[model samples]
Target: MSTELLAVRPDRSLTDGEAALLLELLPPERRERLLWQAEQREPLCAYGLLLLALRRRLGWRSLPPVARGPAGKPFFPDFPEVHWNLSHTAGAVLAGVSDRPLGVDIERFRPVTPRLLRRLGADSAEEALGRWVRLEALAKQSGTGVIAVLNRGLTAAEEASAHDLTVFPGCAAAVVLGEGEAPGQVRIWTLEALLEGLAENF
Candidate 1:
């Protein structure tokens, strides 16, 4: 079964021209939503990275229509068999696709306290964040999110099943695969390079 994960920390901000060109490659819905998300002033758009993942993994130039699950997880209704997920922090964006179900998340390095670690049932800050991301990825996969996961929590095997995705430095990411699935190596991208690639595709 095929599995793909991607991470991109945009090396630089998009120029006006670059942004305009990128809009042309996106589906109409994404263009408007990306614009809405841009208002948050995040370094990169998760949707853009999501588009890159789809193109690179499945050779699809644009997304079909999507619908959200009960928990607000987005999926392609016409392509239910194709499992995919996306996430982003101010510093990085993550995307994944696989033959089996999958979910992913990304976060930049930050200070964490012992108190916070205790809440996550971890002994150290790094372990806490790692556990945090694993919990999030597992939550995303299960469609109930963190709150629910916190209520019932992970088993030893469930926590063990979450794999770190090697992307850019100074970020934490994890992906959870369904039964019998294994993770693929991650591919990192720069926004400038991605823009150039999109231009070539046009």
Candidate 2:
């Protein structure tokens, strides 16, 4: 299965004009959800922008309807064959798309407490964050969520399926793919490039 990762850093809050442009790409039902907290607007807008990019990359004339799985995982009901996951941190947002089931998670880096490090079973802050994201991605891929998976830990199968992703600096990220799916090159796009692609396609 072909898989791709996209990451964006929106350094500033989205302007009214830009928010309107991005909101046009979202389904009507999702519009109200975009009215998030002031701090969340940028990442939320970035997530919407990523969906637009994914739609164009998949050659879909229009964005597909999204549905949630039993575990609250969002997916395309019309495009069952397409698998995807999204994550957002303080200054960035990430999206992963594949032909098979996949999950991704990103977290902004912060100093890890000794207790937290031991809980996650890692030696350093980076290692701790990486391990945390891996577990979260694994849970997301299985549609079980991190709390469920963390309580039990990764099975041997899950251990082999997880892959670490190098996202923006000061952030930790990872992706988990279905068996037999390998990760492809990650494509990082600037906000201007994303806007340009959106303008050209939609």
Candidate 3:
């Protein structure tokens, strides 16, 4: 099964009208979750935009109903053949789509606390963040969340199976695919391209 990963850096130049247009396309649940803060809103909108793009790519007639897994991971309930996961941080949002199970995580750079480092069992801040995203991505891949995996930790075999994705500077991202599945090419989407795609598809 092929996997496609898309990343977008939130555009600060979007006009109020354009923002409304995008917001209108989001489901009521997603639209209501929009934050008053621009920083928060950008990544959320990016997630919605990515969902629209993925739907079009898969030739879905409309946005499918999303259901939460037992561990809080989201999935398309009616589209069992399509698997996807989304993650967003301060300045970037990431989405991964595949024919089989997959998960993706992105985290912006920040100094790690000594307490957090110890909790993550990492020697340094960078290592802690890397390990954090990997563990989180792995949890997502299994339809579980980080809290669950942190409690149990990954098995040795699970540790050996994840793929670390190349991301822009100042951030870390990782993608985890089902065992034996290879990740396909990474795609970086421009804000214009995403907006254009939405206009065409919607």
TM-score of each: 0.87, 0.90, 0.87
Model 3 TM-score is 0.87
Q: Where is model 1 poorest over a 10-residue stretch in terms of lDDT?
A: 38-47
Most accurate candidate by lDDT: 2
Winning candidate number (TM-score) = 2
What lDDT would candidate 1 get against the real structure? 0.75
Between candidates 1 and 2, the one scoring higher on TM-score is 2
lDDT of 1 by residue, 1-202 (tens): 3877777776557677877766666566656777776442232345566667677777887777767899988788888988888888776788887767788988877789877777888876667777788889999988877978977978877877789877767778899987656786787777766667666666
True-structure lDDT of candidate 2 = 0.79
Q: Which residue runs of candidate 1 sit more than 4 Å off their true CA positions? A: 38-45, 113-115
**Of models 1 and 3, which has the larger lDDT?**
3
Tens digit of per-residue lDDT, candidate 3, span 1-202: 4777888877566777667767777656556666455554455556655676577676653456667878788777787788888888876888888888878888987899998999999898888888889988999989776888898988887877677777678888888887877666668877777777776766
Q: Going through the candidates in order, what is the number of backbone clashes in each?
A: 0, 0, 0
Which residue pairs in model 2 clash with each other? none
Off by over 4 Å in 2: none
